[model samples]
Target: MRGMTDLGPLSLSPVMKPADPPGEPLPGIIKTKVFKEEDYINMPWKNGLGGTKQIAIHPHTADFETEEFIWRLALSEVRDSCSFSVFPGYDIALLLLPEDERDGSASVKNTVHLRRGSLTSPVALHHNDQATAVPLRPLTPYTYSGEWPTSCKIRTGPMRHLTFIANRELTRVTATLETICLHGLHDDGECSDSDEAVHKAPGEVNGTKKDATGNGNGTALPLGDECKNPMNGNVNKLLIGNYSIVYVVSGAVRVTIEGTLEPHTVLAGQTLVCERDDDSSPTDLAMTPLRKDGRAFEKESEHQDATVLIIQVNILRPERRRHSSLSDVSSFSQARPRGRSGSIIVYDDQPLPPLAGIDGDTAASSAARAVAGPSSPTSTIPMRSWDSARHYKPPVFSSRFKNESEVPPAVVRDQLIIDEFPVGAISTVWINMVKQGLSEWLRIPVIVARGKEEGPVVGITAVVHGNELNGVPCIHRVISDIDVSTLKGTVVAVPCINVPGYLRYTREFSDGKDLNRMFPGSPTGTASQIYAYNIMEKVVGHFNYLIDLHTASFGRVNSYYVRSDMNDAASAAMAKLQQPQVILHNSGQDGALRSAAMTRNIKAITVEIGNPQQLQNQYVQWSYQGVMRILSWLNMFQLDPADLAPAAGPPSSTILCSKGYWIYTKTGGVLEVYPSVNTVVRKGDLIARIKNIFGNIVDEVYAPGSGVTIGRSSNPVAMAGDRVLHMGVIKREGEVLAREAKENY
Candidate 1:
């Protein structure tokens, strides 16, 4: 329980704290102990839901009022509070904001200020037309009970879209350009040089026909009779080779050769094949065109939306060949998905020169003059799901919380629960986890150990920055003297992950690595990466929940408290259980250990105690009890609520950071801050000031917002445009419940 002395008054801006001594940048990420609060501006309210504000609409009437040329934006002051809506227009966006009237209906106000080119929406009075107007009262609180309209209107620019017309009504067209097709991997059967006694099965070239002149020239040819078309037969398919496979996502086509009376349609349910062969028939083989006038071989516009696949085959021929092999016949290579074969292969109208056969036969030899027709095979390949590819294993020891027996009588009898516990009691546990070879020997130790009893495994780890000693001592005390034997479950602790930096009292490890930022460790990396990987994979990779502890460095100071992303259930539970002097929710940041842990489904929070290098007994006591309270909540131990004192002050309603901004000094100088964290400030309020080294006034920083300050710079000295403070604003509008649930007996 927090006593009167443990709590600090809440303010609008962060209290100025000290800075860390100048040091080298750590190789990895480090957690900063200072609390920073800043300002956030005109965030938007979309249908009562919070989101980015980018719309700007002009009201159709003059009754509503709103800020014009908005400037110097900031957060609101009242905690978790919202004010009246102030704009109006036709439909809702068409009117300016309004003011509440005694008659219970709101009166139209004025137009809102806006930046150029921003898109705006108009509320619709009726769904059928663009010009109808709706009363603005529905947009105000009393009428809608402070609820925003459920739907918003969208308006596009007044421009016409272009349309294109084709000379002919083509059955199908492909919008996206085809991907470049390179020669594919070679793994098919080899080719031979001489046609020497090569007899292909009759169907291999059956029903082949070629329309070389686009006049359906050879449609009367008999099955297996070589046609005059140059691109027919098993030979044409063989030329494409086995390595390349193509999927015709849509459209249809029929393949035929010189001697076929009918063409086979390569449509959705059909398969066609053309192959390369080494048959050395002396007479030149006739070839067939797969299509005529860009349409399927012999069919009309029947399967425009059909799709098919084309796979290339590899053919290796032997050495020694003749020039007849190259010519044989000419004309027709380009074919469209829906027939259309008018694309000429112009290099004098010839296909790519086939590779020299394995026997070194040049293009000059062994020409097979026979035209094989349309009898080819079709195939289908299965597709895989992308979601199933992202599955990952849960962390080690993934288990739910279990109830445990009460704390031992000896611990209660010894007054350990009542007397102020010492700091650093659990320090050795961290060291022991690493020292005992239980944790990965990385720059950041990710280990957590549970007590013997059946309580929750509260994460007690320190050195998010290797040098912060306050948590070190506080944890040491909890583990050393506390009767863990009576405690339920275990108190998982990691004393020093940055072992090298701790000895020097610096923020980074000796290798210039920071332990905090290197979360979700990499599988392959530098020493720091490996360490991070090992820790997460080994230590932290095993726990279900966590608590990362920190303190102000030698140069700074901070109020004792706990940080949480109250949006998370586990985090909220920890914050309430710890019962710190002040519970600051909305403290989440991406890439932090807490964020990473949460991403992996781990419950976690960051606890910040007192600042400065000094160890205050009360602060230490607060830390101890907070841990016990957490353990008690987890059923690791039991304690009397009656013995506990009321929290330091009325629990401030939880404020959310709808938006935030940073304030930097214009010139390097000495800085002084006015508003402190939790202190509410009015718009345009002065938040800080700057002075030269000689104490000459240089500039004064005013609040760009009207919300409470959650954090600020602790260092007094600053450079031109140096960050001097941070602010956040509450933009939520509606009834806010001020009650919170606590662990009850």
Candidate 2:
């Protein structure tokens, strides 16, 4: 009964007391209340599968038995395979909480299965089913309709999750769950007076300054001069919807709403609820640390780094009732089958319904469409069984080609195909290139591999610069070794996108243009432009995710690293999963393939392997392992024991640099690089020294800033203003780096 006090029904008195009219200086004040961990209400699930710790419910005093509440927020734990309680008229959003282990080594095996209509039916045939055989990392939230009798199976042990449920007809809910690490906090019991002084006022320490809009970088800060008072701490503005809730997973803090001067101290594992004011204005609130004898505890030891989960529930217009005929019900029932083993099964003879339109589009043209949109497409494609190694036949093409119209059609099977390749098979296609004369023609080699099951379409292109040969064999091995029967998606690989450059052992195409710089190319442009246009339209545009592999150009060597825009959550997540030795947080330059793909909303990343022109076996292996990790992370394929690299320790520590630069030589000479790739260097550290033909030292290059070497020029010869070393400046501290680096390929 400690935290279980009944606050009675929410009051509208505060908003009704306001005098401000529309467009006035001030709107109505919001009513906010704090609910501590001790006050949480424990309730049994209606289905008896598990129990939930109720944080707050609408109508204020509504209990679990109260059937008319508009929205509800709670935390639940699943220990075994149990059916979820069915709420026929509600929609639910669930987010899996990260485990306590910081190294991400904890074992977590949880599987979610969903079925529509009845609880008596098996839990198979759910489109959104996901199994986490490996540890479950914090991912984007998963949402489903409450009409479905969803269930969870704990393959290894128990799992905890935060959930938001709302009435589908009367309310709409949007939830985003992210984990932010607060650095510079000490874990020890010692605290300094200076730390407490810094916490007395908001935006006073550790780059916490707020802009004119009351926003501090990505952190939301309190608005106006109201935050200047030490007693008030810092105030933050909240535009409350029908209801708003903020829950603390770790650490402690204080909160105060506009109507009251007294602040409420909310510790870790506590929840705060803010009810919408009667008037239609945003809310004002302030937050600070729990104070003891008028002094704030600022040390991280007193308040560990916190991860807060924010949820918003809004009231929307009621959904129109749909009248379904008996035939409609029967057709849907055919797709849902009840099995004796409590596993849902789909019949082979049942015809699949068309994919529901995403964003109101009636139909999707390709597999990529299913992933980019909100809905999954219905596929009639049956799973095929085939021997990938023995039966695979690389497609052959005739050299004599008249025009683009003469290109052959892709081989299709099981509703899945990639340009001349059938499902569960690997084949090659000869993409027509420019001709030297009327009789002689040129073509680029394209490898296409289609998986047996229906999933997203992923495009992988390597050797775009022609001279980058490390990726060519890596692509071949990936395509040849995949067990098509287990794959859930399609794989399209282009071993050599620039055939002319590869044949000529150069980085640019025959027209002396960088192929990578000409993306979504214009059809009426130059030859390279036309080629780029064809690939973007016929290939890259249809991909949900793209991985463009490359190596350091001719004279340079690079550490096994990833170049990605860290600002993007999705791209950053994918890059972290690869566990590379290093990562460059770069917003790609203009016209780059990665940049072009992003404009079209396709998630893409560029991977830098070893040196160019030669296929280093070690780098090839590393590249292969990295790609497998990506595929596994996406749930496109299961990780095979043979394909698994040696048991990895904690991921290699990652250093994120917002800005990076290349050190250029001031005088022409023969260059000698002193440090290897991935070596950390400080300003004035010896990086390289240039010598003239007579063996006399010409100039010595020193590190310009404290950073790690990502790439360096390998060729001995150098010219004035020529880049010799590329370094990334380290600015953030306490950021987790992978503990150990993976073996270099």
Candidate 3:
């Protein structure tokens, strides 16, 4: 009843609004069209397990993959039990239309997101709880996350149902059903096709309906045959909006746009669409049944008999959702739909921007965008649609792990190619990279400093995350200081692992993937996965030890630290030699290079430098000496005790933490975190405060336990679940815990 119709409950948690919308609507724009049943195109489902009748889909060229289509309406056929194809970032609605069978029904078995393709802890939506699931009842609409891996099981034989898919990031979607009564309409059954009119009358629309008297001989048919079903006497107006879909299940409907005298008649089995400019506010719609030229029929006066489905979709603008209200959402780990593997925890990476193209603003990125493969900004949509063939093509990505045949013929190590560098000399080895889906190779330069005497091969990797550039300079200094003649084993350094991301100034791979999280990737995987696989197989597999260097990404800062599996003797020793500000004793099994190298029996430790995208000379020099210490400890090189001193802020007695977790904001506001990078807090100390723009404090965060601040959000703007601080629960805050770091549990 409002400007835009109020919809029923939404399926997913609400997201923060953007500071501004893309643009306003074109002036005075409104378009209307009607499509008959014959217009629907039948297509096979994404899984190829079944088929569907696509009644309507925005951007018709959109394929099964990606979130290119804003909304889609389809009638799906479920013959055998099968899973629903994953559509990771879209809102989905479904309704089971009546089908023939005794005690007949179909139920969707599960809904859960992709957990590395392992299905666990399924939420059965057939009879799901009201809060989490849309109750499955005939003709009753229910909604769920399309990202979840869903499947259907039929109670009877083959089943048919309706599905509505919409990207809430692009537009808001809602549906309602109402009956159209036939009891009070003209008995003549006269519908104006303009051609069907027997007599030409005044006030007749060029292509609209309604104009005759009752033919007493005609029988009033309600819902086709009333004897086979039920009866009612209530008529409802169409719930059309800025973007609306009017699907009449029975009887003819007359659509009359305001300020227009002409009325168009849409017969049964027809869909009428009302569309307005994306930035324009919705207007009220006028609708009635098709009858002889007569007075408009009011909904309250007629008996409901036939049904019409109305779907109202409104593009969300910043003006609609911008507010200072706090949201209830769990931290990233808990927000995931299912359990993460026992050892793999992916909480180390930074949060994505609120929207792809935006700088910090009204919203912090939600867990969804943090996990989406790649997408358009949540606040903007494509200006063009599939009205014709000349529109933007949806993004596509594919790649495979490099095979031996893909490697370069020469200049190599481990027979993954040619002549290897001689011992006792520093050389640059160009590792061939397989271009995604192409035969050409992209060479990745690896610095290999082979020692005169063979010992353990230590691999140092930096810039796996494109923007974490502190590691780049840190690696350069470490390498330049070492002379191959005195060094023992071979030391290899990959200074810019994600070249594409580095070139693009992003934190991920060219395809918007985290190379650090791909691990020893698969032969059949995404672009990032393939590259990661090559790094592990052709390059890292030769190392006896691995050191992955990193730094904090945009909008955040970190203390110089070492992340290692302290339980492992070799890993612990490597971490200790760094003399960092903090040492995190984590399992390190999250798809990270540390854990990936561990799988191949390579002792690995991740040294996180401070800041990103630029070299911090002090930290670089400090960490470079740390690398010399590690080489000295490994008997690969000798180091002078004089070089043990750091060039940075603190003297090197490291704080050891058993584990770390982010203290998140429960509300979004202008935030101020109180601690410096390595500051230690007593339990219950004030850590961060969130204030509204008006300068009044709205929320305060306190340390739940004694811990060292490893990293904290630097941006003043914060959203619910945004990081306040990465608190490392200390085993010892000021001490390096010499005995414990050596061997004790």
By lDDT, the best candidate is 3
Point out the higher-scoring one by lDDT: 1 or 2.
2
The 0-to-1 C-alpha lDDT of every candidate, in the order given, reads 0.37, 0.57, 0.60
Q: After superposition, how far is residue 517 of candidate 2 from its true place, in Å?
A: 1.8
C-alpha root-mean-square deviation, each candidate: 36.1, 30.3, 24.9
Candidate 3 Cα deviation (angstroms), residue 23: 80
Off by over 4 Å in 2: 1-421, 436-441, 647-652, 734-745
Please give the range of 10 consecutive residues that has the lowest summed lDDT in model 3: 398-407
Q: Give the per-residue lDDT of model 1 (tens digit) for 1-745.
A: 0000100110011111112232322222111111112211233221111122111110101011121110011111111111123111101111111121112322112222221122442222222222453322211111111122222221221110000111011111111111100110011211212222122332123433212111112323222233222222122221222112222222333344323344543322122332122341121122222331224233222212222223222222222111102112011111112111221222111244443322224332222111222223552543221111223532221000000111110111111111122121111112211221445432333222234445555567676675566677567545533444345555666666556567677876455766566666576755555556555655564456777777655434444556677667767888777666445554444445666677777788777665544455445556655666776777765654532445422233545444455667777788888766555678898888888888888888888768665456677867786665555555457634233311100
lDDT of 2 by residue, 1-745 (tens): 0011111111110001112232222234454567765566775432223456776655343333422445666777654344455555666666565443322333333333221112332112132244322222232355666656443534435556766666666665554332222221222211222334433244333556332123443343332233342332232436456455666654555556656556666656677766554354666554544423223444434433334555665555312101111011111111221111211222121234344322333343343354454332574554322221233432222111100011112222221236445565444566665565565556666655566678877778888898998898788667745655567778777788888899899999889999888887888999888878777776678788888899989888887778777777777877776667677776665566887787788888888877888876656767777788788888887877555535322135766655567888899999998878777898889889999999999899888788888888888888898888888766477554332222111
Clashing pairs in 3: 112-148, 112-149, 211-292, 211-293, 212-292, 233-303, 233-304, 234-303, 234-304
How much is the lDDT of residue 601 in candidate 3? 89
Q: What is the lDDT of candidate 2?
A: 0.57
State every prediction's TM-score relative to the real structure: 0.38, 0.43, 0.43
Q: Judge candidate 1 at residue 114 and give its lDDT.
A: 22
lDDT-sorted candidate list, best first: 3, 2, 1
Which sections of candidate 1 miss by over 4 Å?
Answer: 1-455, 480-482, 553-555, 581-589, 640-662, 728-745
